[model samples]
Target chain A: MLDHITQTTLLLDEEKCRQNIAMMADKAARNHIRLRPHFKTHQSVQVGEWFREQGATGITVSSLKMARYFAANGWTDILVAIPVNIREMELVNELAAKVQLHLVAVNIETVQALAEALQRPVNIWLKIDTGYHRTGILPHSHEELDAIVALVEQNDMLQFTGVLAHDGHTYKQTDAEAIRTIHHTTVFLLNLVRDRYKGRFPELKVSIGDTPSCSILQTITGVDEIRPGNYVFYDLTQQHIGSCNFNQIAVCMACPIIAKHPERNEIIVHGGSVHFSKDSLMGANGSLIFGRVVELSENGWSEPLEGIEVVSLSQEHGTIRASKALFDRYKIGDLMGVLPVHSCLTADVMGSYTTLDGKRLEHLSGMGQL
Target chain B: MLDHITQTTLLLDEEKCRQNIAMMADKAARNHIRLRPHFKTHQSVQVGEWFREQGATGITVSSLKMARYFAANGWTDILVAIPVNIREMELVNELAAKVQLHLVAVNIETVQALAEALQRPVNIWLKIDTGYHRTGILPHSHEELDAIVALVEQNDMLQFTGVLAHDGHTYKQTDAEAIRTIHHTTVFLLNLVRDRYKGRFPELKVSIGDTPSCSILQTITGVDEIRPGNYVFYDLTQQHIGSCNFNQIAVCMACPIIAKHPERNEIIVHGGSVHFSKDSLMGANGSLIFGRVVELSENGWSEPLEGIEVVSLSQEHGTIRASKALFDRYKIGDLMGVLPVHSCLTADVMGSYTTLDGKRLEHLSGMGQL
Candidate 1:
């Protein structure tokens, strides 16, 4: 199977992926929360089908393009996780007409725009910034929050469903305890907002997402839905953050070693930033690690070899440094599986994937498409 | 025109691109060296045709897949710049049979494999490490260098073309003088190697590349050919390294402002690592700048706005920091052009480009083919 790949190709461990989905879906079931697993990580409809086998129906995506792609493939309910882009109101309306599209509103202007442009009724979630400062209206901004709720209440087409918060700050935590703490505090804040707004909007629920928080929290009390995406295909960043272990990582880049430099003890693989997006995490030694190098075997690969790490990547070449013994083991044309630091960006950069069992999974972010 | 794009799209300034190609082509002509510009930057067949208009007959690519794509598009002379992968011997034979294919060799093992498997003749350039330390055999490694040249000379089908060196170190320097110094030293070292092997290999020539070195050096002597790629779309990194001016940059990502944080003076754009890549460079303030923000207009965009910088990026979201004045000027759905730090990686991640005149240019890196 390894020999058949002539170029840098993304390999998926279907069994591991199934296990990950089962575990996360079971966790959501046990917690009595809807598992609207984010589809932005593995954008493949095939992977979404795996989620369906675990009883997942509703999903979360990062962009309208992804929502349309999944909706075209029969996903009836999809929440575009990011704050609404009013410029794409036409696309939002197109998708809203086809599926139960859920758009996020961070301000009153967005809510007003959606009300005016959306021809069909769509679920609207007010984006709440618990702590992640990247986006969303502050949870403590009562006047701003009230204005969005008031506009949604007046609009017939905009169904105010809930408040959505992505605890993106949890990704910075390096341990399960820290992530859990952030998750608990975030949920408490989001629940406070829910309590304040639930009376006026009786259908309002609470949703919080971020793989590290969802994966580490033992009990998420107030969250009505969990939208963890990276858990489906965890990577070195998640492993470093203590979200998931190495065994649960489902995707790897099978790159052929194209050049060797013994004096520097570095080998160049055909894979690079184009194959694995330039997302890096700190290694155990406190240095930057681009990816973990695993020795490829017949079935898949061995555990990441000790002292072997991808140090740098150019556009089409990855420079890997390993022990002299490991260097001696590989010649030009040998294949090695690189466990990417961040699987979401890796998956998006790869565009598609090949399951170890030989099934090809296609998704959004395909070349030549915007 | 800016209002028409609803999503993140790579915008190419056709006039600037044409000027870039013509300038580099004229420079190569004046220096009496072949201008085999690297096509890995743009990858579009239409962009390649622009080089053809500038009288460029040869091209450089990073992978065999790219070589095949260009070959199919009527590009006759294509050189795969990375170290040769013997696993792609069948591909080398196939491409060599169709076009003037050239492959890079760093060791005798690769030369031997090519000799054993290549049914059709292909040009082979010995890769020489001229202080870049990335790949290639050290120029001081005389015995190893001799063995590769000896084998290629002995083989009937293998054509010994020259010694190829990529002075990637010049990218670290931020001034033209420093880059010119590095380029001069690299050319001197490569020429020394050429003098040593020219007698045994009659076709010995010197080839060196790296956008910074090629763009900064005013007089490139002793080099037979220059393979600068990023000059076609000079980027923020090039501007910082004094390789090209800000106006020479031909590509920028048009990202829609999805969310604005007035409190933090930050605007979130719908472009991230998946679109612009994780490549960054040192800003004027000694901080890592993911990209420079330019105000979008009818024809293209303005210069980098004061105190506006793409500070960080997630998988599909870019968090840009700007002054309060700049932040207030943008609302959700407003478009801003992000000039990427590295245009090559940006172009590859985008997989295509849209000219300011509204023409879409598709390129290599199309999904699933590999």
Candidate 2:
């Protein structure tokens, strides 16, 4: 099955993935904290093993299914990073019985509900709004934290896990320098809280996760654990945001050139938004193309195919505007590779992987999700 | 299972689907032709039943698995609309043996290959390029048409089913009138070829597809069957193209507002490029924000969420910026239904559906393509 696969697939470079693990492991060790990398980005067991090999003892996931999956695969400490919704109590109890389940609570109301509802001992983290206004109770709001902490201390069935923050707000700042400055200030602020509640919640873990910050770490401050997943497959959007260099990018999808319409400055291919998903687009073109169509070289994926500006994509057809020079180079049945603007969307939609050498394998992340 | 099903899911208004079917059925009756609606768009057994109730005896699919799935559920005549990629010869042979399988061939070389490769009598449709140069034998090129006809006549096992042309190029026209003109000319040109091949291939069926033309047509002409799948659930892109108006759209994903980040004018939601795939961002503003996120009314889906602009998206989070009015309207835990630019891409990625009244069910279209 591996040998039979060819074009129109995701290719993951094993060596580069291992390199990313090593880099992240070193960063966590230097910061004197644990590394609980999130599995939401690259949800493959093979990739999960890469993190484990590099000393990832704990992990974070977006859903209960993900937590159960990793736990069955030998991931003992799992954090369900989403706010502990009251409706998911049964699954939480089941998971708590099996592993050290770490649930996130956004407010005192949610914290109180979890404290009253849980039937078994479980660790829970207080979500702090360190400025990602998307979720979490604000650190400045002492009333909110005091109420949550009071309820947790009263509940014998629930263990008080220290505060945790995910500065998802970092992804919004188009400026890379501004992101770093905010991240630096975030760590400084968290350390202040750690000292403030030093004895009350002794050894409380103050964690941080923002792929951009972790991947572009010139300095690691007081963050206890670092979670960055997209570094496994760097994409064009990441490049624009100054996260990972292009050399670190490991996956590419190879598609075929199926048609050429001379009048529209476009050719059609079999790949479309179905294969690539609506992701990042060509700047100012305002079309739906989400990747750079590139030449598939003997070594690996190469330069963007000249004249082939992937202008638009329909459901099953990719519309390419071939540059005058590349128009002649392209024929009806030619093969080309595309570097997706967002690899997470690319890998998720394509649903399978092929190594650069063309060995294909199932993308197991979706299997667990389903 | 039914009670907690969230609004951020595929909800089918079965009533609207039937009306869409009846409308297309009426077009076929008025045109005095057959209708072979493609199943690639709304891949639901229930949707298929609606088409059957409206008197569709034939269907079309993009792959062999799709053909087999439709056949197993009792669709006898199924056209594999994709160019006959002989790589799946075994699957093609298997499907052809059990059902009336129509295979698409554009080049004379492919016709020759079909004749030599399969021992079974395969129904063949020579794809005529009226204008969409994606995949078809050019009807205007007499030499190309003559050569294909000669090959088909020479082959014993190949039975020429018809000359089929999907006027996909009609989609690129600037306005609805231009699209209609392209559709009219393309159909006329194909009918001209039906005359040229009259003596060579008797009992040949001529067909035209491209939903924009067919859906907008108060009357159809010069074709035996109409294959327009997107009409089942017209999208923003379709409505903008003057295909079907807003009230005609039947399917929409109900996504939730997971966070409200007004400072960035963004509300991060759970659905992203993965669910919506990459689709065209169309509006007067010309600022592409991945897609149009709409407000959900109690009766049905509504217009783009007022003052909320979908600016950027990560793998699972669509970040929207809010106008002052939007910020005032949105609260945490609010649900906003997004109307995708392309319904087919969204439908394909979502892979399952729930009714507006909360009935979860499997989607029939995929048939395990992965």
Candidate 3:
């Protein structure tokens, strides 16, 4: 299989990916919350279909383009999880008219824009920031929350769906206990806001998610839905965070070694930022690791070779520093597998993937727009 | 102009790009070296036409696919600057058969592979390592050098063309003198190797390039051709290296502000790693700047706003920390331009760009295959 790879090719372990999806879906089922797995990670129709096989009906995407792409593929319910872009009201109207669309609104302007332009009823989630501080209305900003609630109450086309919070702070916490704490705190804050509006809007739901929180926290409370995307293909970052075992990483980039530097114990592979997306994490040795090198076989790649890590990356070149023994095992024109540091960005950069069984999976990246 | 930019859009200033090309072409002419600008930066037929307008007959690319794409657009000369991937020898052979193709050979195996697979004469450049330590045969690897020379001499399908050295180490140096020293040292080392082989192959040319060295050094000597790609679009990295001024940055990502947090003085934009790439640099205040925020206008974006910087990026969201004045000037629906830290990676991630005049350019990325 490595012999045929001439350039950087993303390889997916179907069994591993299916297992990861099933585990997360089962977790959501046991918790009795909807598992609307974020489709922004894999962005593949086939992978989305796999979620359907495991009984997932609702899905979440980050862009209007992506929501339309999936909705066109027969997905009935979709959520544009990011704060809605009011400038794209035409696309918003078209998608909402086609499917059960859910849009996020973090401010009165966003809510008013959606309310005024919306020709059909669309579920609107008030995005509340629960200490993530990336993008959302503060959970304690009752004045802003009530203003949005008032707008939704007046607008017949806009339905108050729930409070959505992405506990992105969990990504920075390496300790599983810390991640759980952040998750619980985020859920508590979100529930506080949900309870305030519960009497007025009894159908309100609370959605909180981020892969680290969803994977590490054993029990989830007061959340109506989970939106974990990277769990479908956990990577080195997740492994270092203790969220998943090494075997759970489902995606690896197969790159051809174009040059070997024995003296430096380094090999230059034809995979770089365009393939890996420049995402990195700290390794056990306190150095930055772009990826971990693994030996490739016909079935799949072996466990990451000891002491071999992708140390640096340029646009189309990745430098792997390895132990002398491992360096001697490879030659020029050889192929190696790299378990990416962040699989979500890796999959996004790669645009698509080739399953172990040679099936092609397409994504929004393959749509080919400038 | 920013109203329709609901998502991340790469905006190119055509006049700035044309000026950048002409200045470099004139510099190469004055230095009396062939100007074979690297095409991997823009990767667009329209952009290549601009280079052609400057009388650039030779171009350098990093991949066979790019060579084929440019060749289809009537670019006759292309050097695939990266080390030769023997697995793609069929592609190498086909491309070499069609145009004035040049391939880099770093070791005996690469030369031997090309010798064994070649059906037509192709120019072969020996890639020399002159402190970059990325991917090349060490300049002092006399035994390996002689072996490759011997292989080229024995093969009728291979022509001993020249020595190619990419002094990428200059990029890390901020001092002008240090950059000049690296450039001079690299050229001196490459000349030593070339002089030894000059008696055996009198027609051998010496090629050296890196945007920092090419742009900063007053004089370029002992190199037959220069292949600086990033000079066509200097980025924040170049500005810090003293290669180009901020005004020389021809490309900027226009992204809509989807959410704002006045308390944190940060706004969320639709651009992220997928648009600007994860490359970053240290700001004046010692914070990591993913990109510098600029005010958008009809002609172009204003100078990068002081105290406003893109601090963090996720898959589809960039968090910009800004001064209160800068944050107040924009609302949730407004757009801002972000000057990337590294233009090469940004352009590569964006795939293609839209000019200020609203003309769409096509790139190899638009071909859209995994």
Better of 1 and 2 by lDDT: 1
The prediction achieving the highest DockQ against the true structure is 3
For all candidates in order, the CA lDDT equals 0.87, 0.71, 0.88
For model 1, name the residue pairs that clash.
none
The TM-score between candidate 2 and the true structure equals: 0.84
lDDT of 1 at A343: 89
TM-score of each: 0.98, 0.84, 0.98
Candidate 2 interface RMS: 4.3
Considering the true interface contacts (CA pairs under 8 Å between chains A and B), give the fraction that model 3 also has. 0.64
Candidate 2: residue pairs that collide = A277-B278, A278-B277, A278-B278, A307-A323, B8-B254, B265-B321, B265-B322, B266-B320, B266-B321, B267-B320
Q: Scoring each candidate complex against the real one, what DockQ results?
A: 0.64, 0.28, 0.69
lDDT accuracy of residue A157 in candidate 2: 79
